[model samples]
Every structure is written in C-alpha cells, then in structure tokens.
Target: MKNLDYGVIGNCRTAALVSKEGSIDWLCLPDFDSPSVFTRLLDEEKGGSFAFLVSGEYVVTQTYLGNTNILSTRFEAPEGAFTVLDYMPRYRTSEKSHYLPPEVHRYLRVLYGKPKMRILYDPKMNYAGEEAVHTVFPNYIRTSSAVDAEDKIYLYSSVNFDVILSGEEFTLTDHQFFLLSYNQKLVAIDENRVLLDYERTKVYWLNWINRSREYRQYGDMVNRSMLVLKLMSYQHSGAMLAAVTTSLPESIGETRNWDYRFCWLRDASMSIDTLLHMKHQGTAERFIGFIKRILKSREDTFQIMYGIRGERELTEEILSHLAGYENSYPVRIGNAAYNQLQNDSLGYLMDVIYKYYLYFPGTLDEVEEIWEVVRNMVRMVLKSWRSPDQSIWEFRTRELNFVFSKVMSWVALDRASLIAELLHKDNYAELWRKEANGIKEEIHEKGWNEELQCFTQAYENTDHDSSLLLMQFYDFIDARDERYVKTVKAIKENLFHNGLMYRYKAEDDFGKPTSSFTICTFWLIEALFVIGETDQAREIFESMITYSNHVGLYSEDLDFETKRQLGNFPQAYSHLAFINTATLLSEEKKLSRFIRP
Candidate 1:
C-alpha cells in the first residue's frame, strides 16, 4: 500500500524515505550504500519496514519541517489528531574536533497529541538474507545481525506500553516518543536527550539551508531544489548521488531499474553547476574536491560513475533474493554503466571546472591545481571522440556517434581551449580550439540531417532527439540557426504529447518510451527562451513544474499515458534542469515586463 509519494529526511550520512501514512519504507543505515534496514520500497513483505499506524480512520498529510530535512506527518483521526516528527540526527560538530566520526544516528519519532497507535517494527538486514539477534534491556532494545555485529541499533521508548515480543509489536494508548539509533551505546532511554537530539538536528539542517545566498523571484522553488540536492548528497565524501534510493524503474513492469546510489560524474558535474548558481559554493567546492581527489591518480581516463568513496570497478549484478519494486524483477545494486565508454564525462567535468574558474577565478584552487587531470582528460577526449560508446542515454544496444555526445565532445575541447588560454598555454589552447572546430564541422556535416532541416540523434539517423535542444545551451550551435528552429519544430511534430515532450520517439533497447522526461522538457523551455519565444517558454516552464510530486520532487520520467512519475525519486538531473530553466525564464519575464512600457 505504501509508495514513493513520500517526503525524504536525511543527515547526509544516511536518508530515510517516509511515506505519507507515516511509514519509514526505505532507509540505508550509516551510509547511502549501507545495507538497508527498511526497504519496503523495493519489496512489500520481505523488504522490512517501520510503521506506526493509527488505530482508527485518519486523514494523513506529510511535509518537511520548514526548510529542513526533518519530515513530519499529521494523522487526523475520528478519535483525535496526532503528529509524528521524524528526523535523522545531524548536530553540528564540536569546535574541539576537526572532524566528527559517524555517531549513532537516531531516527527519532516524537508524537504530538494522543492517538492510539500500533507499532510494526521489523528489521531485515542485508536484503533479509542475514539473521539479526535482538536483546531486551530494561528501557531499550538493541539489535545486531549475527553476521555483522559491528553495526548495531538500539530502540528505546519515552513511555512504556503493552508490548508483544512476537514480531516486535507494541500497542500505544497515548502519544509518546521513540528513538531508533545505531550510534548511542546506552541502555536507558532519555526523554530530554531525545528532545535535544531533535532540536539539534533541526537546527543543523536549517543552518545548512541558511548558507545559500539570496534566490530571488522563484526562491521557494530554488530552495526546495537546493534542499533536495542537499538531501541526495553524501556527507562523508562530498559525493553527490544521482538519487537517494535506486532500482525504481523508469517504466513500470519494465527492466529499466538501475541503482543510482553511487556517484555519477556526469550527474555530479551537472549538480555542481546548479549548486554554484544557487549560492551553495561550499557544496560545489566539496564536490570539486571529491572529483580531484578521486580522478587525480588515473592518467588519461575517467569513469561514468564511482562508489561514494571513489571506489572503482562497480560490478553489475542482480539481487535475485529480493523481489523488485512493483514485482518488476531483477533488482540490481552496482551499476554496469561504470564500465561504459561515456566520453561525455570529460565535457561535463571540464564544464564544471570552467564554471568554477569563471565564478571564482582568483580563488578556485582546484581549477588551477588539477590541470594535470584536466590535461589528461583533454587527451582522453581527443583520443576517444571519434569512437562509438555508450552515450548519455546509456542505451543497452550498440553505441553510435550520438550527436549529443559529439556536441559535448565539442564542449570538452571548447572549455579546454578556454581553460588553456586562461592558464596561458597559447599553443595548447590553439590546438584544442582547432580540434573543437573540427568536431563542430563534422557535427554540422554528419550529425545534422539536411532533408529534415534539423539535427538528428546520431550521424546517418533521422530519429527525432530531444537532446538537440541542449545544443542551444552550449556554444556549438547558435539558438537562431535555422537548423535549431527546425529541430524544435521536428520534435514538436514527432515527440510531443499534450504539453510534454518525449526524449525520443524511436524504438531502442527499451522500445518506444511511454513518458516525457522532465529534464528534456526543461531543455525545451530553455531553447524556447533562447529563440525569443519568451511567452511560450514561461508558460511551459510554469506548467512543467506542476508535474512534480506533492513535495515538489520529480523522477527521471513521467508516464505519458497516466502522468505518473516513473523513474528514480528526487532525480538530480530533473531538479537541476528545473533550477536552470526556471532562472532563465524568470530573467526573461522580467526583461519583457521592463520593455513593455
């Protein structure tokens, strides 16, 4: 009965997906990649969950605690109304220590007002494959799997209630507080400590949100986007994950599930662009550090993605034991895309560096210091630009010279030339500029379809590509180019349905897509603005955000037939694209208003 239409709460170290009915359906303890303690999101029964249900009929509403990652759910029942405040502890570090080690993060639930509740607490460790042992204490209960004693949890209550040892069930007659923790080692529960823990965690998140500078016009949307990005970020290594939970399908009943818990360099680079634009310079700097620290050792090479801690070699495998989400089979954990030859990574990475240099040229140490890695990346691009590999869409079919990839290849060299010029390497800069021009010329000749009067998906193909809209955002293509106008017209003619735009209409590994990608439409909005269709751009931009869920979040795709979100929850690409498109739209609207008089 539970679904992903839920609010997410996290302390950067870990996150919990709590459904509207007050159930913690998905949570990975200790870290993002850690074994899930509650994962009913993937499977209903065997995948354990923590739920506190009202005894009688109730109307449920859910939201976050005012600009913080703390989630709250209100249950208004016939008997009475009660609210549950849920959060993972994230108190600021003590001035005494330079770094704080992972403490026992308490998932505290404080009930306000009195409502008879039934507790269903089940802990299935390691995909329900490992057996965990529970020991009862006077005021608390501690649990640790027999296989991994190092990771333990303590469950304590603020008030005693009727407890059934069978299935860890409890019956509550009144409101009370409970703490589920892996960091605290104490046996007795403390009410004052629970209250302080909640306050400290709330304050920490608010402080983090307060760090962002002014976001004018659509500040609320920007705030929500920034917070969602922050919630998906891994605190320990500063690696930004593509999404919080993985294996959510891009299409229901299809084998499109992918684990996005690891850090995709492409996604991270795109995220940095958004964060820096939103005045979250600290996050941008940290991610830059994560990349420099991770990729510095490798010579003339990069990956599509890496584990949160910069781990290489993410072997693709199936978790046959666990039933997939919606019974969609073959739940995967590690991503196989890590092995693909995604040459676009170089372009995205260089784009991030170029952004950093442009924003804080005098202060960005990473841009200047990581030149060795930068030089090697340029060399990699020059070597691999002509070869066919997995492009950004990451199709399981054979690779082609995707026009989007070629456009980004042009981006790589263009940025490399600019960076080289900034660093005063005239010869190197000129060489990259010359190479960039060649790629541009090749794209003009081969990547474009003359008869169709627009850019195509790949060389020699006439498939309508939504990614063609992206060419306008980059310098490789001018927005006013007749080819650009024809590309938009071609997509509107072939790929659009109602108000939404599909990524592509051609059948590929997954057959024809049944939904419009949220990010691609955002690209369309940006292109509309660029081509002086400001009125239509604003309308589309405003309407597209309405597709997001109740908490202003989006998945990778939304079903074209039913208008349901169909991919990973809280997708970074969609949100980042939203921020970018919204900002541009707002700016254009202001300009239009100013010029009207």
Candidate 2:
C-alpha cells in the first residue's frame, strides 16, 4: 500500500475517519481507552479503514481550525475542488475543567465545489487477524464476531445513507457528500442528532483552545502542537499516550516494531512541564491528579510506562497474522519496555512536580506524599547511579554507565532539595544535596572525556550522546561553561546530519548503528538556545518543523534518505521537544537585545 497522506479525528475517547487521497483513512468508539474497530493504520490488509477520495489528480492541504484539533483538508481535483472537515467532539462541561468521554463523533462536510468523489467505508474486525460475519440494512451495516472469544465489539453506522458490503470490502458512494458514524456501544444513529453533537464537539474544542495564552511568534504552530498534545491525552485519566498506533517499525522491514499506544511516565511528565510553561495550568493540574491517583492505588513500585488508564500489566504479544507496515515483520502490540527500569523516568516525574510547586506555589499534600515515594527513588538512584540498567535509549544490549541517567538522578535529588526547603520537610535536604553534588562532580570529572574536551555518554567512553544537550537546559551546569560549549560543538560536529541531530551513533548497546531520532534534533535546538546560539537554534528549529507530516505531526524517528517518518506516528516525545524548544526560542527572542550576539 502507498503511504496514505491522512489527517486524524477523535473525540476525547476514541478517534477515526481517514480519507483515501489518504486523509484520516473513520474512527469513533467509547474512548481513547477503547479498542479500535477501524485500525487500518496499524495493519492495512486485515485492519479495517474508511476513506473518501476524488478520482482525478489532486493537490491536498490541511490545517486545524485555529488553536483546536479539528482538522480540515482541502482537495483540489482536476475537475473541481472539495473540502472535508474532520473532528472528534471535545467532551466538556461548564462546571468542570476536564474533558471526559463516552462517545466520539466524526463529521464530514463537502464545502465549495462538489467533485464526484467516492467514499469507502470498510471496517475490519480483530485487527485484520480474524474475520466477522456481516449483516446489512438500508441505513447502516452491522458486523459482529467474538474474535478470540474475549470481549464482543459492535459497530453501528448511520442509516441516513445506503451501505454496500462486498466480502471484506464495504463501499458507500453518494452523489453528494454524507456523514457516517460508528461506535461499539452506540444505540441509534440519528443524522440530525449526530450533527448537533458534532457542533457541540467543535465548539468545545474552540473554546478550550481560546483559553491558551498566545505566544509572540510561532503562535499558530505552538497552538496546533499543543492541541495535538491534548488530543494524545487520555481525558478520563489524564495520561498522555506516546502515539495513537503501534508497530510502525523503527527500521523498515526490520523486526524492531513496537506498540507506542501507552502512557510513558517520562512523556507524561514532559507534557505536564510543557503545559505549565504555556500557562495551561488546568491541563497540568489534571495530569498531576492522574499521577497521584495512580501512585496512591498501586504499590510503591511504578513502571516506566503504563496504559492510558494506569493499566499495570501490559503483556507484549506479536500479531503475526497481520502484515506489518511496509512489510515490517511480526507486528507487535503492547510494550516490553514497561518492565525495564529507566532511572531517568523517576527524575523526570519528580522534576515536573518540583516545577509545578515552583510555578504554582501552593500547599501540595499530594506532592509531599509523592516526595516520600520520590525519596525512595532517589535512594534507588543513589544505589544504582554508577551501575547501568537501561540507557534512556532502552537499548537491548548490555547497559553502560549512561551519564544522562546519572545526570537525571542528580536532577531528582536537586529538585528534591528544593521541595524539602519549600515544604519545610527537613529530613534529607543535606543528604540529598550531598548526593546531588557528588553525582554532579562525577558527571563533570569522570563522565567528561578531557581529551575530547566534551562529556562522554559514560565514563571513559568517546561515544557522544545527544542527551548531554540537556545538561544546560536542566541547569545541571551553567550554559556558558566552556565544557558545556565544547560538548555542544562536539555533538553538532558529530551527530549533526542535514542540519538536524541524532541521539547517538545509533549503534545497538553493542554499538550497531541505527537511524537518527527526531527528538534528539530538537534537543540540540534547546541546547543551542541555552548556549547563546540563537540564530543557529532558530534555523535548526524551523528546519525540524518542516520535517513534520503535512498536518504538523511528527513520528519517533526520521529516515534520512527517504525523509519518511518511522517508528510510531505522532510521537509524544518529538512533540514535547517541539514545545520545549519553541518556548525557549520564544523567550530568547523577547530578550534578544539584552543578550550577547
């Protein structure tokens, strides 16, 4: 299958509706927490997909409606032109600040000239791994099956139009455009009723978007990225997932596929920090509430990642039946990385809490309790900082003394010191400070390769890591320090590729080379800003933004040759890197005259 250029639509719960010219290639269900009834993006053959397309050659352009996540795509066909509006209703209440969900609705409208367009409505059940018995009606089609005999899923579409089901393929063609809706637990489909629901969704998104405090420059891009960040968030629990689909593959046709549909703790923390920095305190507050809730109910031990609803047991399994993306073998669902201990995640979690307290300045009993849990984590880091478990890369090879992990462990303690002083809980301030200093000294002395005049990834290793870029951003070291400047140059000289940066040499832990990570490039921009390379930073920032999908979304990695997005679609970390770096650039622009050229 050709790479379909598609946009995404979603209600706070679940999402669907992609176009064949490859726009959202239709999705609605109970929630983001629900299973897919139309998942063609993951497994095209067996995965069901809905699409709308014109016959002739066409030029496509898409953008969200202002600061909202409502996507509108315009297709200019040779004969005529048409526009498709897609949005998942934003669930909101006047009394509450959060969005919740039960049903998600997608509306498609034909604006301006109406071309003779064909609409295909195909729903594959069981992730293209199993077949379902289909029944048709005048207004809608119903498909039912107990694939694997686990749980039953039902699909109900609107009866305002006709449905044609041929074998596994379903088609819906009309002279004019029409709206089709589906959900597992939907009772009835009323065309007028659903349209009203769609309007409410649109209004809700618009209103929430308007609440954002606009930036001086890049306001539109930042807002759209923020909206995407919100869309990735699971509203019910406030856990932001890394991406919507999984098994997109890191290397095409390689067995490096993974499921990225779960909430990474580090990702959620970065999301919270970005939201707070943007003055979206309400969103940050909701996420903090989610974190506290999860920590309270579960045992002291927390996984690096969890399901959107805080699901603890995510058993990784391969969907062998479905053909992988670009034929990447053994498409896998669920993440095996959940079991690995990434010490950096703990520091990230605490760092956000510490940042919240610094900015908001309130009595956080939850923070206090979480700090106790965090103190134990600091102890874990203290015990294991020198030893390597899994580098932030989550490499499968043997672990090394990842300097970044130790740096983050230092962040955990340093921030814990601030929390201790702020909250007046005087148990471990001295000890934490001492440990933090020790780690900092070790990072500066042992972690730095004086011969190379830059910090190494680990002690006594010449290999460079993009993570060292964070040393200045995190305030681990002064931005103006010679070593930090030298390290920045080293990374720019070595990891830089086509004006972007890679995470490392991309070799396996055993040092086998891999592709460049998109997030790392953005990290370099942030580093540039901190080191007073404003023009260079802005240039790289603009260049990286161009690499996003046509709709301003980014995946985990980018193929340097093909310029194709690899790994999971719309990666949370990449967007987060965008948010953080953009914010820094915005702040720097405001104070440019005062700073040195």
Each prediction's RMSD over C-alphas, in Å, is 3.8, 4.0
1-597, model 1: which lDDT tens digit per residue? Answer: 323587777766777787878888887777888778787888887887777756557788887778887777887765667678887777666742222223333233424444565677777777665666778877677778879887677677764523523533343445467777656644345767767777887787788778775556777777778888987777667799898877888777888889888899888988987788667876777787787778656562688899999998888788887888898777888888888887677788888777766666545565566677678888889999999877888887769988889889999999888878778889999999999999999989998887888888888578888887878676666678888877877877788787788888888887888777878888888877877787888888777877777777778888776677777877888889888877776555332110100
Worst lDDT window (10 residues) for model 1? 588-597
Model 1 TM-score on a 0 to 1 scale: 0.92
Which residue pairs of candidate 1 clash?
104-183
- TM-scores for every predicted model: 0.92, 0.89
Over the full model, what C-alpha lDDT does candidate 1 score relative to the true structure?
A: 0.76
Q: Compose the digit string of candidate 2's lDDT tens values, residues 305-368.
A: 8988888888888877777877777777778888886768877887787876766644667666
Best by TM-score: 1
How well does candidate 2 score on lDDT at residue 327?
79
Give the true-structure RMSD of model 2.
4.0
